[model samples]
Target chain A: MRIVLMGTGNTATVLGRLMKKCGHELLQVYGRTSSSASALASELETNFVSTPGDITDGADIYIIAVSDNAIANLAGELKLGNHLLVHTAGAVSKRVLQKASRNYGVLYPLQSLRKEMDDIPPIPFLVDGNTSEDLTLLYDFAKSISNQVAKADDELRLHYHLAAVLSNNFSNHLYTLAEEYCKAKQADFRLLLPLIQQLCLRMNRYSPSTLQTGPALRGDSATIELHLKLLEHMPGIKNLYTSITKSIQDHYRRTDN
Target chain B: MRIVLMGTGNTATVLGRLMKKCGHELLQVYGRTSSSASALASELETNFVSTPGDITDGADIYIIAVSDNAIANLAGELKLGNHLLVHTAGAVSKRVLQKASRNYGVLYPLQSLRKEMDDIPPIPFLVDGNTSEDLTLLYDFAKSISNQVAKADDELRLHYHLAAVLSNNFSNHLYTLAEEYCKAKQADFRLLLPLIQQLCLRMNRYSPSTLQTGPALRGDSATIELHLKLLEHMPGIKNLYTSITKSIQDHYRRTDN
Candidate 1:
């Protein structure tokens, strides 16, 4: 599998390394910036290309691991009529490469890729394309590296990304928020770590909603009032408290009803 | 240590079983309701006390594992004069026990306890009381069962609880929100599991803020707009999206600046 890497961002750099490790030939690394392309290409022991048209003559796959918005116009700019041009984006459609290449697809690695990561994170790879022929090609390439592979198109991929936020970004924000509360109170944030991890470990066994245990879920207005009164100084937290509790109650009763 | 269990809710059930497993003597199990007392007492292999006044004659400690609002009133109602009394609550103050007994303290297990949980969660028990002497006793008792134990008074305990909500409740809510998004789009929620666990695992190896990698955190408004637009149908989620993005931006700039 002779693959050309485009966009030397976090995902591109990490994926390039993983591909090289997995024995796939990284034909060339391409980036708008020479530094990025050179860094990644050097790491992969391959040639570096700065321009889209400068892509290696023999590459079979052009993985455009660029931003979502850039995919459409970026692919239009790239001349890869014989190569399978794909963007590693969740929101963008594979049709973006329709005019640029004979084939197109997506190879979205469903996790946060880090530039400093020594190795690739264990995450599922999601692949989809314009046609079964295109999809299978991407899937075959993805399966070369990861066993956790799934087929999902633009709509489902977009949906998965949105859900990814709640599960990863948004949930992490809550953790940060919790740390903020600890900081404001002048308490050790480390004290919350065990409980946080415990909550996470429980998700392996139970649905979070079914496992929800708190004053609001119990309909204990007495304790809820006490909690609200205590959090009077923290307006943001208060709103969060009200909304989440209400949602939990709504969901609980909805399920029961 | 011989201990009496008061109340038969989530906290009591978890702690009672944990203490029992640790080879602590169960002096008695007291509950306001006869059925609850009988049930817990039967399970704990201890006598059932019908009333708060009827708590076991002699015990090293009595854990009032009830709701926050009930603590002070229950403390006032109880007739324990010299015996050690502790309430397992976060929002409530240790002073609540001062009215009923001079030797009152807080034995807060810093984990979200649920009855369905068969195993004891590794909670960093936060123990505090009126004096350093009481704290020593409570701390010693706490250390016997939990590896992670800390001394935090009512004020500090309240702060820890808020942090717990942020890390545990709020974080889990974010996951629930993500699950909702996946369901709405007819996508699999299981896809987010590996990513979520990796974020948590990374915390064991790196700073959480340093691990933050998303469109808002990366200053990629293109991806941000795409996510926000996707969340337009969910007004509640829209507000959360706004607040969390603002928080991350503020946090990033503050740290960077």
Candidate 2:
């Protein structure tokens, strides 16, 4: 498939490389920054364009992997033909690309992708298109690169994006909190790595709810009080401890969770 | 090494099974609940005890894998010799076992442990004792099962526990939120499972700080405001989203993260 990839950012770089490696022809790579765009273009052996107008019309699909805010404006400026156009965004809507072309769709990869991600685990692409035929084409293209592909609409995709934020972005911050607490205690951060990994692995065997343990979940208010007292030295961590403890208590109080 | 495993709960069952599999002698499997104790005893082909008084005296190490509040009481109640008394808790200090004997220590496994864990990954065991010799014995016993064992003090172990709460408990709650969001959208939660798994797998390649992404971390108040407005209809979710968003923003603003 001839693909004109958009943007030279994290998602674009990773996706473009994977697509090219999967035997898809890279028509062009577009970005405002020539440093990244040109470098990525050189690597993919494709044209590097800084402007949306510079994108040619020979490509089968236009994958816009730009930031969410810049997406609508960029699509409005692009001179896309009836060629299938897709934006790799979690929050942005597909209708934003309608002005650019009738063959518009979404190819949202529900993962917090990074350039340093070496072995990109099997990504699940949530796809949508203007028509049934276009949807089939997008699905096939996504499946060629990933075994995990699903057809999702605007509302469902937006919902998944929220969930992604909670699981990926918020969860990573939680890990950071753990690192901070460990550092304060003159403890090695690696001590908690095994536990973090095990928590994820346990999902394969049982629901996280069933596996939940600790003072808050166990309803040991005595231990909870002790922990809160211990957190007095760190004001910010103390607040977080109190908030999470309250939330856990509220959950159990209402539903016996 | 002859081991008398007490408490046939999640931790006890896993540890006992692991120790036996590693060619250690399992002298007995005891628990407060008769059904659980009897079941584990039958599985290990060992004696079962409903009380700590039924302890197989003179065992190399007596590990009290009970709740924090119960540890001190249980140790006091147990009519056993000093030998080496160890309580598996991060928050509870080594001093908690003072009633048992002078030969006391802690053998806390730093992982989200449970009996149903399919493949118990190499979990790090944080160990400490009242004396150098006791610490060595505890460390050696921990090392017998897991290669990832470390000598940790109570102060450090408490920090480890705090980190565990953030990484394990807090992260799982985020997952719960994601599941809740999925239900609201009438979308199958399985669609996001692959994405969640990949996020975890990527940890090997990138530190979370380097991979942080979202409206909150990106400093895009525009998208965040939009999300907040949309979430206003859902009071519970809206509050959660607000707190987490504030937490992330505060984190990045301070760390320049």
Candidate 3:
């Protein structure tokens, strides 16, 4: 499949590499910045372009892997004849690319990507297309790189994206706060790695609520109070701690009743 | 070393089994309920006792692996002559066991343990002892079961415990909330597992603050507003979503400034 990768950011770099690894013909790489576009294009052995107007038109798919805010504007600037156009965004609607092409879709990979990761795990691509034929094409393209591919419409994709935010973004922030707490108290942050790893591994076997353990889940008010006292210096963490505790407690209380 | 396992709950079962596996002589298992106590004791090929008064007097160490609230009271009930007494609790102070024995200490494992895990990972044991000589004995015992061991005082342990709460308990609650959202929206929750696993694995290489990604961290309020709108019916999740988004934004704002 001939493809054009339309960004040089994290998603673009990772996805472009995966496509090339799967023996797809990456025709060109385009980005607002010439340096990043040229760098990725060089690595993929593809041509490079600086602007959306300069993007070549003969590719089977034009994947716009830019920022969410940039997707619509970039899509509006490009006109990819009968070739499929797709945006690799979670929150953005597939219709946003309709202005750019007759055949537009979404290729949302539900993962927080890092360009430097040597071994990207099997990513689950949630795909959507303007038509049945286009959807089949996208699924085949997705299957070429990943075994985990499924059809997800705009509405369901958004909800899954929201869940991704909770699972990936919010959870990573909590790790940031945990690292800060450990550093402040002369405790090794690495000590928490086994616990964190085990917690995620347990999710595979048990429902998270069933595996939940802590002062908040146990309703130990005394320990909760102590944790609040411990976070007195960091108001942001304190507020987060308090709110999440209340949410967890409230959820369990409602479920029990 | 002869050891007495006090309490037959999750921690006791797992830790007792680990100690026995490491070739330590588990002298007795003590708990309020004879059934649970005998069950674990039988597994460890040790005697069982229903009360603290019946706890064997000659063990080198008595590990009180009960709930945090029960630790102080349980420690007070047991009088172990000059033998070392330790409680496997993060938030509780080692001093709580001073009444039970002159050589009282702490052997807190900073991990979310489940009794059913056949192969336990090397757990990080945060040890605290009243005396240097006593600390050596505890360290040696900890080394038998785990390669990771460190001396963390009460205040430090509390901070580490606070960090663990954020990393493990609070994060697991977010997963629960995410799973709830997925179930409500008819999206497969299993699809989110790879993303979750990759996020934590990224933590091993990057500080979470640096690895953080999402609409919130990107300062994408349009997407945030849409998510908030989508979460309108689930007020508990909505509030959590709003507060965490604000916190992530605030963190980046501070770091950038």
Candidate 4:
């Protein structure tokens, strides 16, 4: 597949490299800035264009890996001439690319990607297309670079995007908050690393509900009170701690009853 | 060290087996219930004592791994005759065991433990003793079973325990809620597995604050509004979604400013 990569951010750079590694011909890299476009294109050993008008129409498929807000605007500028045009975004609908080409779809990578990462993690692509043939084509193309590819329509993709926010973004925030708490208390945050890793390992075999273990789950009000007292000075953390604990208790109480 | 293990729950069972494997002499296993005591003793190839009076005074260290509420009661019953006694609890103060022995401390394992787990994950032991000498002894003993050992007083242990709850328990609840959301929406929760594992891997090298990426962090109100609308039917998840999103926004806003 001859691919023209749009955008110069994390997703674009990582996905562009991945496509090249998997034997896809990256025809050109496009970025709003010339330096970024040139840098990424040099990395991919491909030509690049700074302007949307300069983007070549020679590629078999055009992948827009730009920010969610820019997808629609960039789609309107691209001239795909009925060639497959896909946008790699979770929140945006596939119809956003309707005017870009006769063959349009979505190729959402469901993993957190960073361009500077030395080892690319496993990417699970969530592909959707305007038609059955386009869907199958996008699926097959996704399969070339990843072992995990699933077809998700706009609604389902939005659901997953929300879930990703909860599981990945929200959980990582908890970690960030915990690290801050540890630092403030002069407790070695590194001590929590083993437990964090253990939870990840346990998730593979057991449901998170069954794996839940804490003062909240045990309904140990004594420890809960103590923790609250400890965090009395830090109102933000205290609020989060209180709300999450209440949520956990509420969840289990409802489920158990 | 000749050890007497108390309680028959997850922590007691795992720590008992670890102690035995690390060449510590298990003198006895004690539990309020005869069956539970016998079961754990048999597993450790040690003697069982249902009553506290039957507990021998020969052990160098008596490890009480009972529930938090039961710690004080169990400690009152035990007669360690000035032997090194410790309770494996993060919240409870070391003073709870003052009556049980002249030398008492905490041997709180910072990792989540389950007796039924096939593999025992790395347990970072946070130890505290009544005296400097006792602290050193407890530290060395913990080091025998775990490579990660740190001396944390009651306050620091409590802080880490709180941190553990936030990072492990709360984050896990997010995973649980996300899994439920996926199940309801007919989305594959398993697809989030790679992303989840990647976050854990990234945590080892990067601060979670630096790794945060999503609608909330990006301040993408359009996607956030769409998500909130989609979650309107599920009030519980919707409330959580709203609270966490606001928290994320508030956090980054403060940090960036």
lDDT tens digits by residue: candidate 1, A1-257: 99888888888988988888899998888888899789888888999988877877688788989777777777878777666888898767778888988778899999888888776777688999877988998999899988789999888898888788667876776676666667777887777777777777878777676566666667878767767886798776677777767766666676689
Q: Using DockQ, give the best candidate's number.
A: 3
TM-score of each: 0.88, 0.94, 0.96, 0.97
Docking class of 3: high
RMSD, candidate 4, Å: 1.3
lDDT-better candidate, 3 vs 4: 4
Better of 1 and 4 by lDDT: 4
Predict model 4's lDDT versus the native.
0.91
Going through the candidates in order, the fraction of native interface contacts each one reproduces equals 0.55, 0.62, 0.90, 0.81
For every prediction, compared with the true complex, DockQ reads 0.51, 0.65, 0.86, 0.83
Candidate 2 colliding pairs: none
Tens digits of per-residue lDDT for model 1 on B1-257? 99988888988988999999889999888888899989988988888987777776588888889877677777778877767889998878888787666788999999888878777777789999787788999999999989988999877887787667667766776777777777878888877777888788767666565667676787778767888898898766667777777777877787688
Query: Which structure among the candidates has the greatest lDDT?
Result: 4
lDDT against the true structure, each candidate: 0.80, 0.80, 0.89, 0.91
Give the range of the ten consecutive residues with the poorest summed lDDT in model 3 chain A.
A113-122
Best model number under TM-score: 4
C-alpha RMSD in Å of predicted model 2 compared with the true structure:
2.1
Local error of candidate 3 at A212, Å? Answer: 1.2
Candidate 1 whole-model C-alpha lDDT, 0 to 1: 0.80
Could you tell me the lDDT of residue B71 within candidate 3?
Answer: 90
Better of 1 and 3 by TM-score: 3
